[model samples]
Target: MSAKRGIELEPDLLDQRIKTLAELGDLTGDLVATASRLAERLPRLGTAPPAVHLALRLREAAGSSGLAGEVEATEREVREYKQMLSEAKRKYEEHESQAREDLRAAEESAATAGPDATGRPGSPRRSS
Candidate 1:
Protein backbone atom coordinates (compact mmCIF):
# COMPACT_ATOMS: atom_id res chain seq x y z
CA MET A 1 0.00 0.00 0.00
CA SER A 2 1.01 3.62 -0.53
CA ALA A 3 2.49 5.64 2.30
CA LYS A 4 -0.59 7.85 2.33
CA ARG A 5 -2.78 4.83 2.74
CA GLY A 6 -0.55 3.50 5.48
CA ILE A 7 -0.73 6.87 7.24
CA GLU A 8 -4.50 6.76 7.00
CA LEU A 9 -4.56 3.31 8.51
CA GLU A 10 -2.40 4.60 11.36
CA PRO A 11 -5.02 7.16 12.30
CA ASP A 12 -7.79 4.58 12.28
CA LEU A 13 -5.69 2.20 14.33
CA LEU A 14 -4.88 5.04 16.74
CA ASP A 15 -8.56 5.79 17.06
CA GLN A 16 -9.28 2.20 17.94
CA ARG A 17 -6.44 2.25 20.46
CA ILE A 18 -7.86 5.41 21.99
CA LYS A 19 -11.27 3.84 22.29
CA THR A 20 -9.90 0.75 23.96
CA LEU A 21 -7.80 2.89 26.31
CA ALA A 22 -10.86 4.91 27.21
CA GLU A 23 -12.84 1.77 27.95
CA LEU A 24 -10.00 0.47 30.09
CA GLY A 25 -9.88 3.76 31.96
CA ASP A 26 -13.61 3.62 32.61
CA LEU A 27 -13.39 0.05 33.83
CA THR A 28 -10.51 1.01 36.13
CA GLY A 29 -12.60 3.82 37.56
CA ASP A 30 -15.50 1.48 38.16
CA LEU A 31 -13.23 -1.06 39.79
CA VAL A 32 -11.80 1.60 42.08
CA ALA A 33 -15.26 2.80 43.03
CA THR A 34 -16.47 -0.72 43.72
CA ALA A 35 -13.39 -1.53 45.81
CA SER A 36 -13.70 1.71 47.76
CA ARG A 37 -17.38 1.21 48.50
CA LEU A 38 -16.88 -2.40 49.52
CA ALA A 39 -13.92 -1.54 51.72
CA GLU A 40 -15.79 1.28 53.40
CA ARG A 41 -18.92 -0.76 54.00
CA LEU A 42 -17.15 -3.91 55.17
CA PRO A 43 -15.10 -2.04 57.77
CA ARG A 44 -18.13 -0.11 58.98
CA LEU A 45 -20.02 -3.37 59.29
CA GLY A 46 -17.50 -4.61 61.82
CA THR A 47 -16.68 -1.33 63.57
CA ALA A 48 -20.23 -0.25 64.27
CA PRO A 49 -20.55 -1.29 67.89
CA PRO A 50 -24.03 0.27 68.10
CA ALA A 51 -25.21 -1.82 65.15
CA VAL A 52 -23.91 -5.10 66.62
CA HIS A 53 -27.01 -5.91 68.60
CA LEU A 54 -29.25 -4.64 65.81
CA ALA A 55 -27.53 -6.63 63.07
CA LEU A 56 -30.08 -9.45 63.08
CA ARG A 57 -32.98 -7.00 63.10
CA LEU A 58 -31.44 -5.00 60.27
CA ARG A 59 -30.76 -8.18 58.29
CA GLU A 60 -34.39 -9.22 58.70
CA ALA A 61 -35.59 -5.78 57.74
CA ALA A 62 -33.30 -5.69 54.72
CA GLY A 63 -34.33 -9.24 53.81
CA SER A 64 -30.69 -10.14 53.13
CA SER A 65 -29.09 -13.17 54.72
CA GLY A 66 -25.75 -11.51 55.45
CA LEU A 67 -23.37 -8.76 54.32
CA ALA A 68 -20.67 -11.32 53.61
CA GLY A 69 -22.33 -12.47 50.43
CA GLU A 70 -22.87 -8.94 49.23
CA VAL A 71 -19.27 -8.00 50.02
CA GLU A 72 -18.04 -11.10 48.22
CA ALA A 73 -20.12 -10.23 45.17
CA THR A 74 -18.72 -6.71 45.08
CA GLU A 75 -15.20 -8.08 45.43
CA ARG A 76 -15.78 -10.45 42.56
CA GLU A 77 -17.11 -7.66 40.39
CA VAL A 78 -14.06 -5.52 41.14
CA ARG A 79 -11.77 -8.41 40.28
CA GLU A 80 -13.53 -9.00 37.00
CA TYR A 81 -13.43 -5.34 36.12
CA LYS A 82 -9.72 -5.24 36.87
CA GLN A 83 -9.14 -8.22 34.64
CA MET A 84 -11.13 -6.65 31.81
CA LEU A 85 -9.26 -3.39 32.18
CA SER A 86 -5.95 -5.22 32.02
CA GLU A 87 -6.96 -7.01 28.85
CA ALA A 88 -8.17 -3.81 27.24
CA LYS A 89 -4.95 -2.04 28.14
CA ARG A 90 -2.93 -4.91 26.73
CA LYS A 91 -4.83 -4.80 23.45
CA TYR A 92 -4.46 -1.06 23.23
CA GLU A 93 -0.71 -1.33 23.76
CA GLU A 94 -0.42 -3.97 21.07
CA HIS A 95 -2.36 -1.85 18.59
CA GLU A 96 -0.30 1.20 19.46
CA SER A 97 2.92 -0.71 18.88
CA GLN A 98 1.68 -1.99 15.57
CA ALA A 99 0.58 1.47 14.52
CA ARG A 100 4.00 2.87 15.38
CA GLU A 101 5.77 0.18 13.45
CA ASP A 102 3.49 0.63 10.45
CA LEU A 103 3.94 4.39 10.53
CA ARG A 104 7.71 4.08 10.67
CA ALA A 105 7.75 1.63 7.81
CA ALA A 106 5.51 3.87 5.76
CA GLU A 107 7.73 6.87 6.43
CA GLU A 108 10.84 4.94 5.44
CA SER A 109 9.21 3.75 2.24
CA ALA A 110 8.03 7.24 1.38
CA ALA A 111 11.49 8.69 1.97
CA THR A 112 13.16 6.05 -0.15
CA ALA A 113 10.63 6.55 -2.95
CA GLY A 114 10.98 10.31 -2.92
CA PRO A 115 13.31 12.33 -5.29
CA ASP A 116 16.69 10.73 -5.55
CA ALA A 117 19.90 12.11 -7.09
CA THR A 118 19.38 13.04 -10.81
CA GLY A 119 15.66 12.97 -9.94
CA ARG A 120 15.61 9.32 -11.00
CA PRO A 121 14.74 6.14 -9.16
CA GLY A 122 17.85 4.45 -7.72
CA SER A 123 20.10 6.95 -9.52
CA PRO A 124 23.52 7.49 -7.87
CA ARG A 125 23.94 10.97 -9.44
CA ARG A 126 24.67 13.59 -6.78
CA SER A 127 22.70 16.80 -6.44
CA SER A 128 24.31 20.20 -7.18
Candidate 2:
Protein backbone atom coordinates (compact mmCIF):
# COMPACT_ATOMS: atom_id res chain seq x y z
CA MET A 1 0.00 0.00 0.00
CA SER A 2 1.12 3.51 -0.82
CA ALA A 3 0.08 6.85 0.62
CA LYS A 4 0.72 10.20 -1.00
CA ARG A 5 3.25 12.33 0.81
CA GLY A 6 4.02 15.99 0.32
CA ILE A 7 7.62 17.14 0.49
CA GLU A 8 9.54 20.12 -0.77
CA LEU A 9 12.16 19.15 -3.33
CA GLU A 10 14.67 21.89 -3.89
CA PRO A 11 18.37 22.38 -4.41
CA ASP A 12 18.71 23.84 -0.91
CA LEU A 13 17.30 20.60 0.48
CA LEU A 14 20.40 18.66 -0.59
CA ASP A 15 22.34 19.76 2.44
CA GLN A 16 19.58 18.57 4.76
CA ARG A 17 19.39 15.24 2.96
CA ILE A 18 23.15 14.82 3.21
CA LYS A 19 23.02 15.51 6.93
CA THR A 20 20.19 13.06 7.33
CA LEU A 21 22.19 10.41 5.51
CA ALA A 22 25.15 11.05 7.80
CA GLU A 23 22.92 10.70 10.82
CA LEU A 24 21.51 7.45 9.44
CA GLY A 25 25.04 6.21 8.94
CA ASP A 26 25.85 7.02 12.54
CA LEU A 27 22.78 5.13 13.75
CA THR A 28 23.68 2.12 11.62
CA GLY A 29 27.19 2.23 13.01
CA ASP A 30 25.74 2.04 16.50
CA LEU A 31 23.53 -0.86 15.47
CA VAL A 32 26.52 -2.69 14.03
CA ALA A 33 28.44 -2.26 17.23
CA THR A 34 25.54 -3.55 19.30
CA ALA A 35 24.93 -6.46 16.97
CA SER A 36 28.62 -7.36 16.95
CA ARG A 37 28.52 -7.63 20.72
CA LEU A 38 25.30 -9.61 20.74
CA ALA A 39 26.98 -12.94 21.38
CA GLU A 40 28.94 -11.60 24.32
CA ARG A 41 25.90 -9.75 25.61
CA LEU A 42 23.74 -12.86 25.52
CA PRO A 43 23.34 -14.60 28.87
CA ARG A 44 25.01 -17.92 29.63
CA LEU A 45 22.52 -20.55 28.47
CA GLY A 46 24.14 -23.59 30.13
CA THR A 47 25.62 -26.74 28.55
CA ALA A 48 22.44 -28.45 27.36
CA PRO A 49 22.23 -29.26 23.62
CA PRO A 50 19.06 -27.24 23.24
CA ALA A 51 20.58 -24.27 25.00
CA VAL A 52 23.77 -24.52 22.96
CA HIS A 53 21.77 -24.76 19.74
CA LEU A 54 19.71 -21.73 20.70
CA ALA A 55 22.81 -19.77 21.63
CA LEU A 56 24.48 -20.65 18.34
CA ARG A 57 21.39 -19.69 16.40
CA LEU A 58 21.21 -16.41 18.22
CA ARG A 59 24.85 -15.71 17.51
CA GLU A 60 24.36 -16.48 13.85
CA ALA A 61 21.39 -14.20 13.75
CA ALA A 62 23.46 -11.44 15.31
CA GLY A 63 26.60 -11.95 13.22
CA SER A 64 26.36 -14.14 10.16
CA SER A 65 24.94 -12.17 7.19
CA GLY A 66 22.51 -10.96 9.79
CA LEU A 67 21.91 -7.77 11.78
CA ALA A 68 25.53 -6.69 12.01
CA GLY A 69 26.26 -7.48 8.41
CA GLU A 70 23.13 -5.76 7.20
CA VAL A 71 23.91 -2.69 9.26
CA GLU A 72 27.45 -2.49 7.98
CA ALA A 73 26.26 -2.80 4.41
CA THR A 74 23.66 -0.11 4.97
CA GLU A 75 26.28 2.18 6.49
CA ARG A 76 28.52 1.69 3.50
CA GLU A 77 25.69 2.51 1.13
CA VAL A 78 24.79 5.60 3.10
CA ARG A 79 28.36 6.81 3.10
CA GLU A 80 28.55 6.23 -0.63
CA TYR A 81 25.35 8.15 -1.21
CA LYS A 82 26.60 10.96 1.00
CA GLN A 83 29.81 11.15 -0.98
CA MET A 84 27.87 11.26 -4.24
CA LEU A 85 25.63 14.01 -2.93
CA SER A 86 28.63 16.00 -1.71
CA GLU A 87 30.21 15.76 -5.12
CA ALA A 88 27.01 16.88 -6.78
CA LYS A 89 26.72 19.78 -4.36
CA ARG A 90 30.24 20.88 -5.10
CA LYS A 91 29.59 20.77 -8.84
CA TYR A 92 26.36 22.68 -8.44
CA GLU A 93 28.06 25.36 -6.38
CA GLU A 94 30.76 25.69 -8.97
CA HIS A 95 28.25 26.06 -11.78
CA GLU A 96 26.22 28.52 -9.78
CA SER A 97 29.31 30.63 -9.17
CA GLN A 98 30.16 30.54 -12.84
CA ALA A 99 26.62 31.53 -13.78
CA ARG A 100 26.70 34.46 -11.34
CA GLU A 101 29.99 35.56 -12.78
CA ASP A 102 28.62 35.33 -16.27
CA LEU A 103 25.56 37.38 -15.35
CA ARG A 104 27.72 40.05 -13.71
CA ALA A 105 29.91 40.21 -16.78
CA ALA A 106 26.86 40.60 -19.00
CA GLU A 107 25.49 43.38 -16.82
CA GLU A 108 28.85 45.14 -16.77
CA SER A 109 29.13 44.80 -20.51
CA ALA A 110 25.64 46.25 -20.96
CA ALA A 111 26.42 49.14 -18.63
CA THR A 112 29.56 49.92 -20.60
CA ALA A 113 27.80 49.62 -24.00
CA GLY A 114 24.98 51.94 -22.86
CA PRO A 115 21.51 52.53 -24.38
CA ASP A 116 20.18 54.25 -27.58
CA ALA A 117 22.14 55.14 -30.72
CA THR A 118 24.59 57.48 -28.95
CA GLY A 119 27.89 56.12 -27.49
CA ARG A 120 27.34 57.77 -24.05
CA PRO A 121 27.42 55.00 -21.41
CA GLY A 122 24.66 56.10 -18.98
CA SER A 123 22.93 58.99 -20.83
CA PRO A 124 19.86 58.45 -23.00
CA ARG A 125 19.46 60.10 -26.46
CA ARG A 126 17.33 63.32 -26.40
CA SER A 127 14.70 64.00 -29.05
CA SER A 128 15.53 66.78 -31.49
Candidate 3:
Protein backbone atom coordinates (compact mmCIF):
# COMPACT_ATOMS: atom_id res chain seq x y z
CA MET A 1 0.00 0.00 0.00
CA SER A 2 1.03 3.61 -0.53
CA ALA A 3 2.31 5.81 2.33
CA LYS A 4 -0.77 8.06 2.14
CA ARG A 5 -2.87 4.95 2.88
CA GLY A 6 -1.39 4.95 6.42
CA ILE A 7 1.85 3.02 6.05
CA GLU A 8 4.32 3.66 8.85
CA LEU A 9 7.31 6.01 8.34
CA GLU A 10 10.82 6.03 9.72
CA PRO A 11 11.11 9.29 11.59
CA ASP A 12 14.93 9.19 11.70
CA LEU A 13 15.02 8.66 7.94
CA LEU A 14 12.79 11.68 7.46
CA ASP A 15 15.01 13.64 9.81
CA GLN A 16 17.99 12.69 7.67
CA ARG A 17 16.19 14.08 4.62
CA ILE A 18 15.61 17.35 6.46
CA LYS A 19 19.27 17.40 7.49
CA THR A 20 20.33 17.02 3.87
CA LEU A 21 18.17 19.97 2.87
CA ALA A 22 19.69 22.04 5.63
CA GLU A 23 23.20 21.16 4.44
CA LEU A 24 22.26 22.24 0.92
CA GLY A 25 21.06 25.55 2.29
CA ASP A 26 24.38 26.01 4.08
CA LEU A 27 26.31 25.28 0.90
CA THR A 28 24.22 27.80 -1.03
CA GLY A 29 24.88 30.42 1.60
CA ASP A 30 28.63 29.76 1.40
CA LEU A 31 28.53 30.11 -2.39
CA VAL A 32 26.85 33.49 -2.06
CA ALA A 33 29.42 34.64 0.51
CA THR A 34 32.30 33.56 -1.74
CA ALA A 35 30.81 35.50 -4.64
CA SER A 36 30.55 38.59 -2.48
CA ARG A 37 34.16 38.23 -1.37
CA LEU A 38 35.30 37.86 -4.99
CA ALA A 39 33.39 41.02 -5.94
CA GLU A 40 35.02 42.99 -3.16
CA ARG A 41 38.52 41.89 -4.27
CA LEU A 42 37.97 42.96 -7.89
CA PRO A 43 40.47 45.53 -9.22
CA ARG A 44 39.38 48.95 -10.43
CA LEU A 45 40.88 50.04 -13.79
CA GLY A 46 41.32 53.81 -13.49
CA THR A 47 43.45 53.49 -10.34
CA ALA A 48 46.08 51.16 -11.91
CA PRO A 49 49.33 52.36 -13.52
CA PRO A 50 49.12 50.62 -16.90
CA ALA A 51 45.65 51.90 -17.61
CA VAL A 52 46.57 55.34 -16.34
CA HIS A 53 49.62 55.43 -18.65
CA LEU A 54 47.51 54.57 -21.63
CA ALA A 55 44.99 57.21 -20.72
CA LEU A 56 47.74 59.76 -20.14
CA ARG A 57 49.30 59.10 -23.54
CA LEU A 58 45.94 59.50 -25.17
CA ARG A 59 45.33 62.76 -23.36
CA GLU A 60 48.85 64.10 -24.17
CA ALA A 61 48.30 63.47 -27.89
CA ALA A 62 45.06 65.36 -27.53
CA GLY A 63 46.94 68.25 -25.71
CA SER A 64 45.57 67.48 -22.23
CA SER A 65 47.56 66.48 -19.08
CA GLY A 66 46.30 64.44 -16.17
CA LEU A 67 47.78 62.76 -13.11
CA ALA A 68 47.91 58.97 -12.96
CA GLY A 69 48.10 56.85 -9.77
CA GLU A 70 50.30 53.86 -8.82
CA VAL A 71 49.21 50.30 -9.34
CA GLU A 72 47.78 48.28 -6.44
CA ALA A 73 48.25 44.55 -5.81
CA THR A 74 44.48 44.18 -5.64
CA GLU A 75 44.45 42.77 -9.18
CA ARG A 76 46.50 39.74 -8.13
CA GLU A 77 44.41 39.31 -5.01
CA VAL A 78 41.26 39.51 -7.09
CA ARG A 79 42.52 36.91 -9.54
CA GLU A 80 43.36 34.51 -6.73
CA TYR A 81 40.05 35.08 -4.99
CA LYS A 82 38.12 34.66 -8.25
CA GLN A 83 39.73 31.29 -8.90
CA MET A 84 39.08 30.14 -5.33
CA LEU A 85 35.50 31.31 -5.50
CA SER A 86 34.90 29.49 -8.82
CA GLU A 87 36.21 26.21 -7.42
CA ALA A 88 34.22 26.64 -4.22
CA LYS A 89 31.04 27.32 -6.22
CA ARG A 90 31.57 24.24 -8.34
CA LYS A 91 32.05 22.05 -5.27
CA TYR A 92 29.00 23.56 -3.56
CA GLU A 93 26.79 22.83 -6.57
CA GLU A 94 27.99 19.25 -6.79
CA HIS A 95 27.40 18.68 -3.07
CA GLU A 96 23.98 20.33 -3.27
CA SER A 97 22.92 17.96 -6.06
CA GLN A 98 24.12 14.94 -4.09
CA ALA A 99 22.38 16.14 -0.95
CA ARG A 100 19.10 16.59 -2.83
CA GLU A 101 19.36 13.05 -4.18
CA ASP A 102 20.08 11.69 -0.72
CA LEU A 103 17.05 13.51 0.67
CA ARG A 104 14.82 12.00 -2.01
CA ALA A 105 16.10 8.53 -1.27
CA ALA A 106 15.51 9.02 2.44
CA GLU A 107 11.93 10.14 1.81
CA GLU A 108 11.29 7.09 -0.37
CA SER A 109 12.72 4.81 2.29
CA ALA A 110 10.51 6.42 4.95
CA ALA A 111 7.43 6.02 2.75
CA THR A 112 7.99 2.27 2.27
CA ALA A 113 9.54 1.23 5.59
CA GLY A 114 6.51 -0.58 7.12
CA PRO A 115 3.32 -0.06 9.13
CA ASP A 116 3.59 2.33 12.11
CA ALA A 117 4.57 0.28 15.20
CA THR A 118 3.76 3.06 17.64
CA GLY A 119 0.20 3.56 16.40
CA ARG A 120 1.45 6.99 15.42
CA PRO A 121 3.35 8.10 12.28
CA GLY A 122 6.82 6.64 12.86
CA SER A 123 8.71 3.39 12.99
CA PRO A 124 9.46 1.61 16.31
CA ARG A 125 11.96 3.58 18.35
CA ARG A 126 15.16 1.88 19.44
CA SER A 127 16.98 2.54 22.71
CA SER A 128 19.80 5.03 22.27
Candidate 4:
Protein backbone atom coordinates (compact mmCIF):
# COMPACT_ATOMS: atom_id res chain seq x y z
CA MET A 1 0.00 0.00 0.00
CA SER A 2 0.98 3.62 -0.53
CA ALA A 3 2.44 5.65 2.29
CA LYS A 4 -0.66 7.84 2.48
CA ARG A 5 -2.95 4.84 2.63
CA GLY A 6 -0.72 3.20 5.23
CA ILE A 7 -0.87 6.32 7.35
CA GLU A 8 -4.65 6.46 7.02
CA LEU A 9 -4.99 2.89 8.20
CA GLU A 10 -2.41 3.19 11.01
CA PRO A 11 -4.24 5.61 13.32
CA ASP A 12 -6.88 3.05 14.32
CA LEU A 13 -4.40 1.01 16.32
CA LEU A 14 -2.91 4.02 18.01
CA ASP A 15 -6.34 5.45 18.73
CA GLN A 16 -7.50 2.25 20.34
CA ARG A 17 -4.34 2.00 22.42
CA ILE A 18 -4.63 5.57 23.59
CA LYS A 19 -8.25 5.04 24.54
CA THR A 20 -7.39 1.93 26.56
CA LEU A 21 -4.54 3.73 28.29
CA ALA A 22 -6.84 6.56 29.27
CA GLU A 23 -9.36 4.15 30.77
CA LEU A 24 -6.61 2.41 32.75
CA GLY A 25 -5.35 5.72 34.06
CA ASP A 26 -8.82 6.71 35.17
CA LEU A 27 -9.35 3.39 36.93
CA THR A 28 -6.00 3.64 38.69
CA GLY A 29 -6.87 7.13 39.89
CA ASP A 30 -10.19 5.95 41.28
CA LEU A 31 -8.50 3.03 43.02
CA VAL A 32 -5.99 5.33 44.66
CA ALA A 33 -8.73 7.61 45.91
CA THR A 34 -10.75 4.69 47.23
CA ALA A 35 -7.73 3.29 49.03
CA SER A 36 -6.99 6.64 50.59
CA ARG A 37 -10.57 6.92 51.83
CA LEU A 38 -10.50 3.41 53.22
CA ALA A 39 -7.33 4.16 55.15
CA GLU A 40 -8.77 7.38 56.52
CA ARG A 41 -12.07 5.90 57.65
CA LEU A 42 -10.65 2.68 59.04
CA PRO A 43 -9.36 4.39 62.18
CA ARG A 44 -12.39 6.62 62.74
CA LEU A 45 -14.92 3.81 63.02
CA GLY A 46 -15.36 4.68 66.76
CA THR A 47 -14.94 1.97 69.37
CA ALA A 48 -14.67 -0.97 67.10
CA PRO A 49 -13.86 -4.50 68.33
CA PRO A 50 -10.20 -5.25 69.10
CA ALA A 51 -10.05 -7.69 66.19
CA VAL A 52 -11.24 -5.00 63.80
CA HIS A 53 -8.52 -2.59 64.93
CA LEU A 54 -5.98 -5.36 64.49
CA ALA A 55 -7.20 -5.93 60.95
CA LEU A 56 -7.03 -2.22 60.21
CA ARG A 57 -3.48 -2.12 61.51
CA LEU A 58 -2.56 -5.03 59.31
CA ARG A 59 -4.12 -3.38 56.31
CA GLU A 60 -2.20 -0.15 56.94
CA ALA A 61 1.01 -2.06 57.27
CA ALA A 62 0.49 -3.46 53.82
CA GLY A 63 1.38 0.00 52.49
CA SER A 64 -1.00 2.27 50.64
CA SER A 65 2.02 4.54 50.15
CA GLY A 66 3.54 2.10 47.69
CA LEU A 67 0.28 1.82 45.83
CA ALA A 68 0.05 5.61 45.66
CA GLY A 69 3.52 5.78 44.18
CA GLU A 70 2.67 3.23 41.56
CA VAL A 71 -0.49 5.10 40.65
CA GLU A 72 1.49 8.32 40.23
CA ALA A 73 4.05 6.68 37.99
CA THR A 74 1.36 5.06 35.89
CA GLU A 75 -0.49 8.37 35.58
CA ARG A 76 2.63 10.09 34.37
CA GLU A 77 3.24 7.35 31.84
CA VAL A 78 -0.32 7.68 30.59
CA ARG A 79 0.09 11.42 30.08
CA GLU A 80 3.34 10.92 28.21
CA TYR A 81 1.82 8.25 26.00
CA LYS A 82 -1.12 10.53 25.17
CA GLN A 83 1.22 13.34 24.26
CA MET A 84 3.26 11.06 22.04
CA LEU A 85 0.11 9.82 20.32
CA SER A 86 -1.04 13.38 19.64
CA GLU A 87 2.33 14.31 18.19
CA ALA A 88 2.43 11.24 16.01
CA LYS A 89 -1.06 11.97 14.66
CA ARG A 90 -0.14 15.56 13.91
CA LYS A 91 2.99 14.51 12.05
CA TYR A 92 1.10 11.90 10.09
CA GLU A 93 -1.49 14.45 8.99
CA GLU A 94 1.27 16.84 7.93
CA HIS A 95 2.92 14.11 5.91
CA GLU A 96 -0.40 13.14 4.32
CA SER A 97 -1.15 16.72 3.38
CA GLN A 98 2.26 17.15 1.77
CA ALA A 99 1.89 13.91 -0.11
CA ARG A 100 -1.49 14.97 -1.44
CA GLU A 101 -0.11 18.32 -2.58
CA ASP A 102 2.81 16.60 -4.27
CA LEU A 103 0.47 14.27 -6.11
CA ARG A 104 -1.75 17.15 -7.23
CA ALA A 105 1.21 19.15 -8.48
CA ALA A 106 2.57 16.15 -10.39
CA GLU A 107 -0.80 15.58 -12.02
CA GLU A 108 -1.04 19.24 -13.03
CA SER A 109 2.47 19.17 -14.45
CA ALA A 110 1.72 16.07 -16.48
CA ALA A 111 -1.52 17.52 -17.81
CA THR A 112 0.05 20.83 -18.79
CA ALA A 113 2.99 19.08 -20.44
CA GLY A 114 0.65 17.57 -23.09
CA PRO A 115 1.51 14.61 -25.35
CA ASP A 116 5.24 15.00 -25.88
CA ALA A 117 6.32 15.57 -22.22
CA THR A 118 6.08 11.94 -21.06
CA GLY A 119 9.66 11.31 -22.23
CA ARG A 120 8.76 8.23 -24.22
CA PRO A 121 11.25 6.82 -26.81
CA GLY A 122 9.30 8.21 -29.80
CA SER A 123 7.80 11.34 -28.15
CA PRO A 124 8.84 14.67 -29.68
CA ARG A 125 10.38 17.42 -27.57
CA ARG A 126 8.65 20.82 -27.46
CA SER A 127 10.22 23.81 -29.22
CA SER A 128 12.21 26.06 -26.88
In TM-score terms, candidate 4 sits at 0.63
Give one digit per residue, the lDDT tens place, for model 4 in 1-128. 67756524477787888788778778877877766666565455446698688767845743466555566677778878877887887788798899999999987897798867666687777789
The best candidate by TM-score is 2
Q: How accurate is candidate 3 locally (lDDT)?
A: 0.52
The reply for model 4, stretches above 4 Å from the true place, is: 1-9, 38-65, 120-122, 126-128
**Count of backbone clashes, every candidate in sequence:** 0, 0, 0, 0
How would the candidate models be sorted by TM-score, starting from the highest? 2, 4, 1, 3
Steric clash pairs (candidate 1): none
Q: Cα RMSDs of all predictions?
A: 10.3, 7.0, 16.7, 4.8
lDDT of 1 by residue, 1-128 (tens): 67756533344555566566667656655664554444344222454666664654554433323443454455566557656755766776789899999999977876777645225566665569
What candidate 2 gets wrong by more than 4 Å, as runs, is 1-11, 40-43, 116-128
**What residue pairs are clashing in model 2?**
none
Q: What is the lDDT of residue 33 in candidate 1?
A: 59
Please write out the lDDT profile of model 3 over residues 8-82, one tens digit for every residue.
444456555555655654555555454444434424448678977765555443331211111112333444555
lDDT of each: 0.57, 0.81, 0.52, 0.72
After aligning candidate 3 to the native by TM-score, how far in Å is the CA of 68 from where it should be?
Answer: 12
Provide the clash count, candidate 2.
0
